[model samples]
Target: MFTVIEEQEQRLLEIRRALHRHPELAYQEKQTSALIGKELDRLGISYAAGLAGGTGIRAELGKGTGPCVALRADMDALPVLEETGLDFASQQSGVMHACGHDGHTAMLLGAAELLARSTVLDEIGGRAALLFQPAEEAGNGAEAMIADNCLQDVEMIFCGHIDTHHPVGHLAVDQGLICSYADPFLIEICGRGGHAARPHEAVDAVVVGASLVLNIQTMVSRMINPARPGVITVGRIAAGAVHNVIAGRAVLEGTIRSTHPDTREQIIRRMQGVVRGLEEMCRAEISFTLHRGLPAVVNDPVSCALARQAAREVVGADQVISQGFPSLGGEDFSFYQQKIPGTMIRFGAAKDPSAGPAHSGSFDFDEKVLACGSRWLATVAVYGLRYLQKS
Candidate 1:
């Protein structure tokens, strides 16, 4: 049944590899966007490019006009050097698709081509939107797309991340939240400078910052509900210019994620409280700012049911999994759900067990899922379009 899909996706995979070779960062995916546009055009589908406040591209198909089912893929790479020794490994230094966004883009582009050529899809009252977005790594891309009305007519959205954590060709679908709200924060503490020998002369912003970092952990361990999941970690700290002298300024940066918004608010409030407490204790002034990243990735229940049916059609029911809960990971795709019903499926990227997981820079995905992901996305759009028609 998927033989034609396999043949068509092989070409799509060639396109994916070409992208992998020349990885681009957030907001700078001109070539990548252009490639997607060209492919959609070749498939006889019309598209819009330079969208969503960045290098966003989109394509539309079918005339039934039921509901617009948007299939989205990110068009950005991470700032990591590629160590994978594939023939098409990233030539761009310090930027690679270590997170499998390259595969995501290819899969969705493949789906666009498949749907463009599918009579069954069009017969189901299909109206599809293909979104090629940028700045997902930087966290502002989705907001840019939303601001541009990317979700105006979208009835439902479907997206997937390559999961090296799961076995090859295994698809994971879940109802409700599948990922957490990741927000990065920066804190600046100001204090009096002094010589190292004179501990009392300086307000010791470093000490205050250290105290705040330690106390911040309590928000998750002590304050937040034990049953609910939450995480707080300080990733970086820059203070004191010299080892022998106490610097007047210090910085603390980290991220906080949780399943619930109230819990997130509590964590933020508690973190601020800790900083405020340290300020009073150390007599150091502090300023803090939390830049929004992504809201929790919540999979709509109705959309999830349809996804299960689609996955079963593509890879049998045994391949579909619905047992796990959401992770603390963040996804910009959540932005789509904010405007329309959506499900973020996890396509297994670890084809070989010997290979390590994603984000390792050396991590490589089981490209076999290229076929699986492509068909699954196409099927979901068909299901969503059909569901919209019935409603």
Candidate 2:
């Protein structure tokens, strides 16, 4: 398997660079989706296009019957300008594959290239499903794909993310709570507007909003258990337009990330109490809107075992790591795991140890990870199917 991937290493590099040159945003991957389709066509891998808001593609390899395992890759870019000086850096201004989605997409395509030529699927009476999902950054792509029945008849699913923090060839395949549940919230405060000079006459929305932000920050420390990993971050705040006049309205946008459901609910309830108390004390109307986001990615132990087996085989036993701590970061891949047994491998792609993390303007990874990731995906798919058949 490694030899096959090595033979196509140059081809994979070209494909990843081609994708890196033209990054597309969530649900708007027209050219990216087209390119994937083109590659699938070349590999003679039949797939259905125009799904999941017209960007998700599902391709199948092997016989139509028997057990099936699926592998997924996200296709989307961040709204950040590129700063990497690489010749193949993103050509699209204010849009870059800063999070290694470009690498993820290319690796999945590389896996497709390998699986298309292999006979394991046929021998095991199984199939491999490849999903090129869009809008993972927007956090709804997985749901859209599921709505389109992308998980239909799929027994086990696997996906991977490029982790720049770890060296190339390492894979993190730990089971249970690998990622956090993300919940976004918006707080709007409405207060009486009056002359700035007459401080006694108006309720200052800015002051109330600022106080609310401070109070919300304390929820994690005061209300939620200190032992559990939880974060409440107010990322953006908007208030008065002018300096002289008292603002009538203010908006605060933030997110809540937690590992357990009890802790998440505890924070939400405490936030409501805090908002109510602040509103009563300041005589302002406060509205809190929390949008339920992706669930924590808790890998199934059985599925993770398959990933671990594949990772060990592809990159040796030492390169396969069992992560000790869960990430506060969220992933839409959790949506798929909610429906069926699934796990996500964090593939190490860091080319430089000091390089910036994902979503940074200069983020890039070692192209060598492409072959390793592809081999792991292909290997895991076959192993998952065999495991299912035996059970």
lDDT of 2 by residue, 20-113 (tens): 9999999999999999999999999999999999999999999758998999999999999888888998889999999989888988998898
- Once fitted onto the true fold, the runs of candidate 1 whose alpha carbons sit more than 4 angstroms away are 1-6, 351-356
Residues forming the 10-long window of minimal summed lDDT in candidate 1? 1-10
**In model 2, how large is the Cα lDDT of residue 217?**
79
lDDT of 1 by residue, 107-206 (tens): 8887877777778665776688888889888887988888887777888988888888777778998989889999999999999999999988888888
- Model 1, residue 60: distance off in Å is 0.6
Worst 10 residues of 2 by lDDT: 1-10
Name the TM-score of candidate 1.
Answer: 0.95
